[model samples]
Target: MFVLAVILSLVTAAVFAAAGLAKVQGAKQMRDAAAHLGIPWDNYRLIGVAELVAAAALVIGIWLGWLGVLAALCLTLLMIGALVLHNRAHDTVQAMAPAIGVGVLALVTLLVRIAA
Candidate 1:
């Protein structure tokens, strides 16, 4: 269970880190992507930064146990919001994929952590 939790945490963090980096470092591309999801570019940089921080927290939280749970919860919410924004933009495919994927991972991480 502990091993599962660690693997899940790492995977989740990596995915989010990549996504966040893309958004933060690749602003123009991210803005275009956000436009597809109906998110204005105005605060995208901030969002990206938050994502990066959250990703880091997830990794750090793994050692702290409870912090890992909190990080997972935060990421789950972020995924939800992203899904909502995508849906609002009529980007059903894009919205559903990451939302569902990340949500499932977050849930799994939560379950494993609790079990451990």
Candidate 2:
């Protein structure tokens, strides 16, 4: 279970880190998506930094159980927030799919850690 949790955490971190980097890079797609979601363009970099921090914490948590658990929990919350934003914006499945997927993965990792 621990091994599986670690693998999941790593995968989640990678996905989110890429997303964070894209936001920081001001990728056109990400900017447009954020705008569509009603998020201010000025906050894009901040969101990206948050994601980067969460990603780092998640990977570090592999060695420190508490850190790992905390990061998983935070990621789960972030995903939940994403769902809410998508719902509020009445976004299409295509827009919400990534959030749903990442949220589920984060929830799984968090649950597995709790079980352990």
Candidate 3:
């Protein structure tokens, strides 16, 4: 269970780090996504920063499980917001799958963090 927690934490952190970096860099696709979600560019970039912070917390959480739990909870909430925004934009389920999938992973990581 401890090993599982570590692996999940690293994988989740990596995904968020890449995604956050793209958003912070204002990649074309991320810009388009922000527009689609009706969020201002600055606010969207702030969201990216939040993701980066959470990813860092998860990395530090390898030794301190409580931080991992906190980070996972934060990611889960962020993903929930993403799902809501996608729905409001009338996006297809395919478009929402990544958020849903990552949200599930975050939730699972949270549970593992607790158990471990």
TM-score of each: 0.86, 0.93, 0.97
Candidate 3 residue-wise lDDT, 5-106, digit = tens: 999999999999999999999999999999999999999999999999999999999988789999999998999999999999999999899889998988
Candidate 3 residue spans exceeding 4 A from truth: none
- Residue-level lDDT tens digits of model 2 in 1-116: 88888888899889889999999999999899888889997786788888899889989988888888888898899889889999999988897998899899889988887776
Clashing pairs in 3: none
The residue-by-residue lDDT of candidate 1 on 4-104, one tens digit each, is 88898899889888888888886677888777766667577777888788788889977888888888888778777877777777776854786688778
TM-score of predicted structure 2: 0.93
* lDDT agreement with native, every candidate: 0.79, 0.87, 0.94
On lDDT, the leading prediction is 3
lDDT of 3: 0.94
